[model samples]
Target: MTPSQRTLLWVYAAIIAMWPIRHLAIWFIFRKLDILTPDSPRLTMDHPPLVTAIIPAKDEEGTLAECLASVCAQAYPNLEIIVVDDRSTDRTGQIAREFATADPRIEVLTIEHLPPGWTGKTHAAQQAADRARGDWFWFLDADTRHSPENLEIVMEYARDRGAALTSLLPEMRCETFWENVVQPLAGIVLMQSYPLFRVNNDRSSLAFANGQYILIKRSAYEAAGGHHAVRDRFVEDIRLAARVKALGLPIRVAIAREIGSTRMYASLDQLVRGWSRILYDALGRNPWRLLGRLLDPLIFSQTGHVAFVVALFLLARGHTSPFAFWLLGLSVVHHIFTYTVLARVYHMSVPRSRYVAWFPVANLVMDVILIRAIKMCLTGRVTWRGTAYGPTVTSSTRPVTKPVSPN
Candidate 1:
């Protein structure tokens, strides 16, 4: 082989060797990070504070009833549930109203219009918060189902930790073929980008929270400027958590698999649209960060696939080398090991994790969706729950809402 060709082969071998080391480091860090669970012994409180649970609905008729039922059955004594029907053309409003009629604690707020510069979900949350009488505010999605003890345990944890804002990552429920494969891949990427341990313990201004279930003290919510503070943000949950953390308040995030689960999307098309509205905007519209995120998984997780492709090309040209073969084998082993670890961490079954070999397909799908999301955002064509937003829209706009009686 020519000296230049030999140099290229060494470079490729070095790159492949780095991936396994990175994966090992990630595994070590992940094992050390605290994985909060709800199975711990419950704590008792002298005074059980009233918590206003807000549910924002927009074309969520399929899941709203179960969500309401779960929230209504919470073991907590002092709790009120508010369901915001965000101009749904479906039975979401009707279901919420029925729950309201049956349970006096459940109130339905029907949103007639989504004002400019406000995302529908944030607008609905703001409306509920305005009329909330609780000392703490709980923002939950219409798709999430909570255990009866969910509220009690989460509240107890918040009180014990003195946390101003507490967000629980719900157990993800995936039923479809796409959901099973893509969800785990997406989650690994997300966690790597926003490490939960760092987000929880780091005082360097980084913060994150899942909107499926987030609870914040009323004082901290107000001090952080509330939902109206992030009215236009597509990923309002993370932004709100950042705002609260910026005020020097303690914010905690935990895994709540035992307490709740969320079915984020029913089908592939819906999943694409839903995540497209989030991923790009979550990058803060920074091109460099977006590029880095797009390439991260390809380099670290898919090094085996990359190596194989390169090896195939070299083989066809009759330029194969032992270094290339060794790199290919190493990359494959590293990829499988990393994926298995990811599956175990994310609570996927062994059968489901056997599909790790197909990760290249999943990774490609994710890349396409992310690139499309970026395009949609840049073109001012981002739409969520029937509301379209412009590229220039920001979270600084205040939402207008009339107060309603919590009683």
Candidate 2:
């Protein structure tokens, strides 16, 4: 091998060294996180603060009923449910109304028109908050199904931590084969992208929140300008968390399997589109960062698989590098450790955790999501739940300003 090629091999080997460190460190940090479970000590209050569960759903007829039912069944004494049907061209409104009729605590709001500058969800949430009579607002997605004790447990956690904003990273309920193989891996990537270690730290400026299950103090939410502050953000959850953090209030996220569960995407098509949108926003719509994310699998965690194969080929051609073998060894051990951790902490079923062995295929899926996200960013528009949004707030370079109203 040429001297230049030998030096390049060393550079590559150094990069490979990072794979195990990054994965294992993240796992350890995850292990240290205090997760809220059914058995966790519940917070008792002389008078519990009212919690308003606001669900913003568009064409979510299939899932809205279950979500509303879960909210209605909350163990917390003072709780109310508000369902927002955001221009759904389906039975979403009807289902919500049925639930409202059955339960006095439940209310439905039908949004017939979306203002020009606001995204459908933020607008719906903003309107709901305006009429809500609660000290706290729980913004939940239609896909989420909570345990009876879920709200109580989260309220306990939030109170104990003194957090102004608390979001749970739910136990993902993955049923399909593809979902099982890809979902956990997607979460791992997302965790890396968001870096919960700093997010949970009050001193750190970095912050993130899961929109699927978020609990925010009404005062804090309003003080940070509520969803209206992050009206145009595709990743409003994260932006809102930043807003709260900027106000010197702590925002925290925890792995709360017993608190609730959510099936984010029902099929492969939904998975692709949903994940692409999230990845696009996570990268901050920066083309360079998107490119780096696209190349992550090629050079980082999964690089060892392809590098090992090439190493074998080079050996057959009487060309060999010790670093290649070193990296191959590292990748193999890393996968084994990761799969073990998955079985131990992530997936309840050992067989399901074995899906981590399919990392190579999952990496391909990640690449595809990255590509789709890049395309969306370049087009300057993202279609989510049948709504297309462009730059629509002052946060971006081009601002689209309009009043928040119902027509």
Candidate 3:
């Protein structure tokens, strides 16, 4: 090869080498929080803040009633539940109205018209927050089923820590094929990218929150301009977290393994639709930047290399040597160490985590999905919550009606 070509090859090698090096730094430096069942703290408040539970539902009738029932059953002393029916063509509004009638603490609003630059969910949530009478606002998805003790536990944690914003990384219940394959990758990427240590210290640029369940102090939410500030953001949770940190608020996040759970997507199509909605914005549109994220699985998943070495030994036959065997042994050791560490930190069962052993193929599949997601995002053809969203999209400015009780 010519001198220039060789130099270019070396540059490419360095680029590839940089990814794993960065991941190694993250794994070593990121502090992990204790993940076992936590003990309840003694009450320190004379009167706990009134917690407002906000649900933004769009064609989510199936899960709306159960979600409402769970919130009503919370052990927290002071609570208000608000469900925003974001132009649902289904029975969402009717279900919410029925719940509100039986319990006056519940209020339902119907958003007949959506405004410009506002993502549907956030728009509905913003309206709900505007009408909320609670000291704290908890934004929850329609699909998540909460335990009765959910609010009490989270509120205590929030008060003790003086958190401006807090979110629970619910225990994921994966029953489908797509869920098993894709869900593990989410935790892997999260562990690899946003190490818990740096996030707690509030020093790094890596900011994140699962939007499924985020609780923010009312004052903090309003001060940060609330959901209005992130109306245009596809990945609103991270954007909101970044805004919270910018405001110098004390932000706390924890894994709610036993507190709550969700079945995110039941089918592969729904899974892709859910992820694709935010992929381009999540990684940004720059190809170079996206390539950086594409390499994370490799850093986290070394088991694929072991399989390669085994295949190489079989193919080499007579050509196999002591050095080859030594290399294979090292790869096995690396694979075992990485997966074991992951299992402990994330509170994952080792049996289920053995799935990490096939991460190479999974990584490749994730890359394709990401690429497709990015393409959809760039083309302005992203659809979410049964609504087609694009750069040219606009909402009707017509005023909406306040919901009336079913009775």
Per-model TM against the reference? 0.89, 0.87, 0.83
lDDT of 1 by residue, 55-151 (tens): 9998998999999999999888899888888878999888888888788998878777777778888889988999889999999999999988888
- The global Cα lDDT (0 to 1) of model 1 is 0.77
TM-score of candidate 1 versus the correct structure, residues matched by position: 0.89
**Runs off by more than 4 Å, candidate 3:** 1-31, 34-38, 42-46, 202-206, 298-310, 313-318, 321-334, 341-354, 357-361, 397-399
- What is the TM-score of candidate 2? 0.87
Q: How far out, in Å, is residue 149 in model 2? A: 0.8
* lDDT (C-alpha, whole model) for all candidates: 0.77, 0.78, 0.70
By TM-score, rank the candidates, best first: 1, 2, 3
Provide the clashing-pair count of each candidate structure: 0, 0, 1
- Candidate 3 local accuracy as lDDT? 0.70
Between which residue pairs do clashes occur in model 3?
Answer: 31-197
Model 3, residue 101: C-alpha shift (Å): 2.3
**Tens digits of lDDT, candidate 2, 300-329:** 656666666776676677655665555456
Least well predicted 10-residue stretch by lDDT in candidate 3: 345-354
Error of 3 at 66 (Å): 2.6
Tens-place lDDT digits, model 3, residues 146-259: 776777777777777777888777777777666766766655544444555655556565666778899999888988888999987777887887788788777777766566
Comparing 2 with 3 on lDDT, the higher-scoring candidate is 2
lDDT of 1 at 124: 90
